[model samples]
Target chain A: MKVKVPKTLLTEHVALLERVIPTRSSNPLFTYLGLALTPDALVLFGTNGEVDLEVRLELPTEGEGRFLVPAQPFFQLVKSLPGDQVELGFGAELSLSSGSFSTRLSLAPDEGYPELFFPSLEGPAEPYPLQTLLPVEELLKALSHVRYAASNEEYRAIFRGVQLEFSEGGLRSVASDGYRLALYRLAKPQPFAKKVVVPARSVDEMVRVLKGMGEGEVALALGPGVLGLATSGSQGAAATGKGQLRMAVRLMEGEFPDYERVIPKEFPLKAAFDVEAFREALRRVSVLSDRQNHRVDLLFEERRVLLSAEGDYGKGQEEVPVRLEGLPLAVAYNARYLLEALSPLSGQAVLLLSGPTSPSLVRPGEAAEGYQAVVVPLRV
Target chain B: MKVKVPKTLLTEHVALLERVIPTRSSNPLFTYLGLALTPDALVLFGTNGEVDLEVRLELPTEGEGRFLVPAQPFFQLVKSLPGDQVELGFGAELSLSSGSFSTRLSLAPDEGYPELFFPSLEGPAEPYPLQTLLPVEELLKALSHVRYAASNEEYRAIFRGVQLEFSEGGLRSVASDGYRLALYRLAKPQPFAKKVVVPARSVDEMVRVLKGMGEGEVALALGPGVLGLATSGSQGAAATGKGQLRMAVRLMEGEFPDYERVIPKEFPLKAAFDVEAFREALRRVSVLSDRQNHRVDLLFEERRVLLSAEGDYGKGQEEVPVRLEGLPLAVAYNARYLLEALSPLSGQAVLLLSGPTSPSLVRPGEAAEGYQAVVVPLRV
Candidate 1:
């Protein structure tokens, strides 16, 4: 197989493939990337067993063939190649040449390369039971806000993922790590109700792929065991035209916790504080918080809220002015959780509390965005 | 003790101390920084057993006292504090107040804090046998060129240091890991000859200190077992004023190898190539070089050089145009070593070759810079 392609476009696509390719795997074949040339395009494939990614480049070719090469070294060679175009030829070995630079990469045996499922919009044998199209911006915004709260603990399968819930209202994303929960409502209603828990690791890769797709609506197909995302349009006006990217993730099989019941419906007390000032105070006070629990106390008052923390190292206190309503109250929270929950919000933030030990709700200045978070107070 | 200092000045000084203070140490006392308040200045002390650093900031104070605090936590608090002016007070605990933020840090047992010697210029009790002041730029340039060649192996006492040679000719810094050698001559003659080997780790800290010192001359004092570096004045006009920093590093004990003997004095062949082009070509070809030796072969012809490398992955080749002198030659060298040695040079780089298996010379386009490197060839 022989093909000549623009170096910049090739480098960009290879980098995307590199992100999904595992550096090492128990199945050694998984560490290799499949390079296949068809009559119309060159395709690159990468996977970590659970998630697979394919990037297609449309280029005029001499012959058609498929081969596998070590992902990392091939990436390095592609990035380091000089000039505007690179010619790839497969004969005795996979030969790559661009300007004065050329390399013969030893091909990994292709017999063991696993067949990957390619998701397409039009296909009679499509395995997906449900398919939906949503604005990339809205989906990305929701993922960014909720992804941070997902649990990283391996034993807690359901909590280690971001739950995508579809109902008559809209598509909502929820993530919780027991102590804290974050939920984002995208407001894109679906025809049928559905729920899927995507592993946090794969969610991160999906974010990367969606970002690279660039300013276009994404088509998401949901199956019993697999979730597929595909983008067919070019990146931009001057981008490599007609190239396509597709990604698939084996879904996590488990029931996500009933998070709706835990989200507080009523708050007897409400306090609005400048987000930047409150965040700064929390960071300073948390420096002295106990290492084990990272607990910081917040005492709500008439015109200000006092924050304090005491640990083996020392004790710290700071006061931030807040517009308050209802009776003054006090709460103790894991400072790290509160900090992370506050990180994705800006302008003014409202703290809605029910009692001392109950989960408190945090909302952005404008609740119309449908972004909310809940933090369970630590027992003193 | 009580004092009010500008937050920016305190932060800058604390950052310098943070560099020398070990995050964790077998001697627990070494993990704390000594905060001493004098009538004239506030002095901060940090040490890592082998190296010590002190930063002095002159500020008006209400009282004078010296205490010790956990270095890392205190640094974090100082960095996170708000406002421009910070008020520090010591009573039951160390109290720090900046704007609306305040913290009381529990002091580490000050009785156990080690006593560190502060080097000065006016004292007759000076223990240094030799003292010299050189332009910071010259010293920094020399250090950058030679530091990379120093061996990191802990057992190699002498090779794990950059040897400083002060003689009638000039102050020359040299380092070698046995396979390669790098030397930079400062051309500033000394009054009395002296030689010292500063450990590579200490050299790194010295670099940081020198860079922070900005535009000025650095004073170097050589004791029997310690090397002292001190810089006075401020960083710049719009910087912390009247602050001073001093650093002491315990010198490595051992006799350095005679590196001059390996530097080739005569060459039967010479090849001059564009530094940027040659470097790019080398980077591309080295992607397929053997993992262990990283060997890349150079075949010098009449007007160009061919570079090739083969390993388990595959083989790569590239051609770079060069002005050749004397007989055509072929030689191989570790790509990593050659790359590092060439990193400090630009414009046209001349390769002086003596033979296939002997140490070759690498010099910048204009050799007047007094920088030279010797890389031993790998046997093919």
Candidate 2:
């Protein structure tokens, strides 16, 4: 179909498609990006068996043509050509001629492209303000950190997935691989109360879409058996499964244990210090930490807090002066998790609330923004 | 031995070591970077089973201490730490203490460090005029044009490497992977006669050292079995094989095939145009190339270079005006190779010298700067 679309818009969509498109695969049909020319818009979908990516761009179309250009050449050509206007002449062979660069590239068969449809999710689609939509970037950053810690070889569902819990206080994310647990939470809007476990694959795609989301609020929809989340943007506006533009995420059907109970609520000992100071100290100490060692000992004494992690290799210790409350306590917790959780803390002051040899609640103080961590004690 | 050394220099050595060091393999010594400290110098050696690297710096020491540091934590900790001069305290723990950052890393047993004896080569240790040295940056820039053409997985050893042939004319470099070849030469060089196949890996490392070598010349020590080429700066110098202050290289022993046989010395038909103009056209036309069949059929007529690569997926073609000499010729060649080979050409005019269905010779006719390619004609 003959259409006139904004060059930047088309280029941006194509750029994102290029990132998600499968390159080295036996199925050339999978490489085809489907462009459906509608009366007032153009719908582009790039799917490679496992994931379906749909982006709907507003355009002026006089006639209709389905352009299934071979993904590789088209991306390469568009990237190489410096142009504001690209004339796409679709016949038996799709020819995209760029006026600016004086270049023309032909594409593969459009008909050979497999039909991609959004799976029929049982629940109704709910829209979320792209911003409010589960700390899009924040949650993604947290997931990527500890996702490395999750066990990959095991076929057990929860072991390879990240647990997302939205409760009375805010949102919490936890990932573990039996030996250690990385728990991260951000205290924000309080009304919601729900929990869902998302596989790494889903989290990856979510991270992909979240890349474009800015200050706008992202809407989230949690279904009975599935999870549907959409952000307001060109990416979020993509026409996905079936005819919908929202991404349909299949939530893991597995039991996520009570990570909360593992977090000790009452501590006879407590230590308060600068979050930045502690994070910096940990960064220094972590350098000497044994990768095989499970923990970094946090010793609380009068007017001082010591963070140390070392083993047969060597020892790294950082002592930061702090106001000690409750009682003196020395507990060992995973340094990796402490670093992961401390990273998201926005300000300087941090409250290291301990439950005497129990799981420690490392929460960002009132002046500090967001973020908290709960670490199960490690016997050094 | 305790002395404060610039962290950046130590970090730089560690960075290089990390890339070359391989863990968990035979030749366990390859994973350890030998640290030899005298009152005058601190020399570090990093070696993989395939490649070895040695760098030296100045640090005060009470006496000579030679040991190999386990590269993993040593490199990792060095990278993470931020400081100018870090106090190096090697005692019972061998700890590197900096403020809050302290790590006592394990050292690999020091039994197998290659005995590093400074090489006193046959070549005039009398330095080549610094101005006479190959402008490393220039050579590196030129090498990149053909480096990609070298086959990564070499079924045939020479084919997998870059051929550096030096005759009376100049330095001609040719790299290919059967499907295509990229041939280029620097016409302006002092008289030299010798031929060698330099490993692409060696070339890559040489390029890294050459990046800052502006007017500084590379000292050539043509050894009995190797090409020992070294570059020096105010700080130090490095090369291919095991050497002290000077870099040494081992030349390939096998004979490289006669590349001249495939090159077209005489072309009855020819086309000439601006080098960059032709390069841009090739790049644009290449976007239409199908991986299944990698060819761009050029139909040269009266005054235009009509490039076409058509197959099942699609067709890509571009036509640009050019100056031609002799009879008209039509031939097809790998578009990717043509684009790559032509990309480095910077002259105002490009000469496409062709014969009766022979491989086309692409060179800059009026342009004096060197680089020429003999593309084997493809049957359309």
Candidate 3:
């Protein structure tokens, strides 16, 4: 196989490679990226099995055959080369040549390369436009916060993945690390869907790749042990290149817990205030919280909300005026989760969907667009 | 204590506090930052006993007074408030008021705060201008690479400190963590000086603060358990604030190891090339260097060099042309240290300061300005 591709496009594959691929994989086979240099396109993939990145580029392909170089050299060659076209050749000897420099790299046997999966969107596949998949920015924001709540340890295999439930009203994503749980629900939803626990790493990589593509319709296909994402029409104007690309990754199999009961939907006492204002306030409050401390309790009244943290020395309380609903109530929460929920949101007002001595959901006004939830009341 | 100061200055103090104060100190006493809010100044100190930060802000004294508050709250409070002049009034209770926000923070007994030994940079203190101090940027670059080689764990208390030696010729800084050693020397000397082990933390913090400021005389004072750095003139014309202010901190005590013997003067082979060109090549080569693998084994021949790394499957190598100095020789090294030494200078050529084995010094051509050294050779 031989192909000449634009250096910039090839570099994009390198950029995504580092983000999706784990620096150290216990299995040596997993460390190698799958590089398929076709006649019309050069497709690059990097994954540790769980989180994979597949970036496709229509290299003017110049009709080359196919070859797969080891991840490191392939990435390094593309990254170091000058702008213009990078000529890649495969066969008896794999070679990446550009400008005055042409280096031949050793290739691994393609027989052991892990096969990526993409659920066929043909039969029984729900059809949804790119826009309908979910706004890239909003999804990125929700995933960032919820992903943090996933257990990074090997204590509970299932807890490591974030659970996502999609129904008619919207999509709810939940993650728990035993100690604390974070929930985020997008108010807008597709016609109908179910739930699944996606490996946290894969979702993060998918979000990072999609975020760079601007506003575009990303077709998503969900299935057992596998998932697929394909992009077509963009949000604003036509983005450069074909934009029709697919990334297929394997999913972790486990029993995701029922997180619905974890979030208290009926917040007895509600409060409304500027989202940024509250976010900044919570950030300040967090600084004073004990490094070992986890939640900040919210004491809500008719027209004021008091955020407080009790530590060894004393209690730290800050009150901000806010119009509330129902009787006065106080609910505790992890200040970090609260701050995370507020960070991505942008709105004039934030509505605290709370409950007495129960978990509270923090959602910004419609203008904020994004959604985030923090389960509180860990107890004093 | 009662006084009003600019928020910007207070914010700067907080920035310094965030780094100097460790989140948890072995001794609880070290956890509290000694705040001597005298009528004349606000002196704040945070130390892990190993590395300490004592910063004094001269607040115009109007009414005579004093107080001490918890460091974290004080930093958070001042940061949360708005406006320039922050009214800080205290007697039995400490109240810091700004704009419409008012926070009354409780203070710890001033007696509980430890008294820091503020060194006398006063008596007959000698001043070393830029001409003698070596380019601050050179010192910084050298420190950046060498500090990483220092042991993070203080198994050898003195080894954790960066040993900086001086003589009539110039200054050389050395740091090693048993596995690797990095030595950097300047081309020329500035007037007079002695040697001392400046704690890596102190050197790092000083470099960070120094980067913000310019070319001026940095008065040096080396005392028992102290190394004072006071840059008197404007860091540069583009510098900010009253650049005349001097910042000094104490250093660690002890005679550093004799490291000059570590750099061998003679080698069987040597090759010279452009510093940047070699650095980039080494960087690409480093993508495969792991603790388990000696990334590259370099061979120097007639005006040419070959760098090869043998992986689990096969071997890969790159040949670069250079200026040869001795007989052809081959040796292996951890590619990282070699890449680091190849950085930090401006010139078209680099002189390979070599030894018998892979242990060699990569001196970027500006030897008259600055120089760097690295010791390598383990498994090839």
Query: How many residue pairs clash in all the candidates, one count each?
Result: 0, 23, 10
Interface RMSDs of the predictions, in order, are 1.2, 3.0, 4.0
The 0-to-1 C-alpha lDDT of every candidate, in the order given, reads 0.86, 0.62, 0.62
Give the top-scoring candidate (TM-score). 1
Comparison by DockQ, 2 against 3, better one: 2
Query: What C-alpha lDDT does candidate 2 achieve relative to the native structure?
Result: 0.62
Error of 1 at B105 (Å): 1.5
Q: Give one digit per residue, the lDDT tens place, for model 3 in A251-329.
A: 6676576665666666556677877666665665555565685567677777877776645433455667787777887
RMSD for each of the candidates: 2.2, 5.5, 5.6
| Better structure of 1 and 3 per lDDT | 1
Best-first order by DockQ: 1, 2, 3
The local lDDT score (0 to 100) that residue A297 gets in candidate 2 is 78
lDDT, model 2, position B147? 74
Task: Give candidate 3's error at residue B84 in angstroms.
Answer: 3.7
Across residues B274-322, which tens digit of lDDT does each residue of candidate 1 receive? 9999999998899899999999999999999999999989999999999
Candidate 3 Cα lDDT to native? 0.62
Which portions of model 1 show Cα errors greater than 4 Å?
A123-125, A235-242, B123-125, B234-242
lDDT of 1 by residue, A180-239 (tens): 899999877876688898989889999888888778777788877888887765633125
Q: Candidate 2 residues B1-380, lDDT tens each? A: 77566677677656655766787658777767677777666677765544455666654555677777677767767776645666676655466866556667666567756653223333344232112235555567556667777777748777777777666676677887765577766764734566667777876765564553445455544434455445553433222222233344455667567666777666677677777767777777765566665777777788887877655556666777877777767777777666666666675555555553567666656546556666666665
Model 1 in CAPRI terms: which quality?
Answer: high
Pairs that collide in candidate 3 are A1-A65, A39-A64, A130-A217, A215-A235, A267-A354, A295-A333, A332-A377, B132-B190, B214-B235, B226-B251
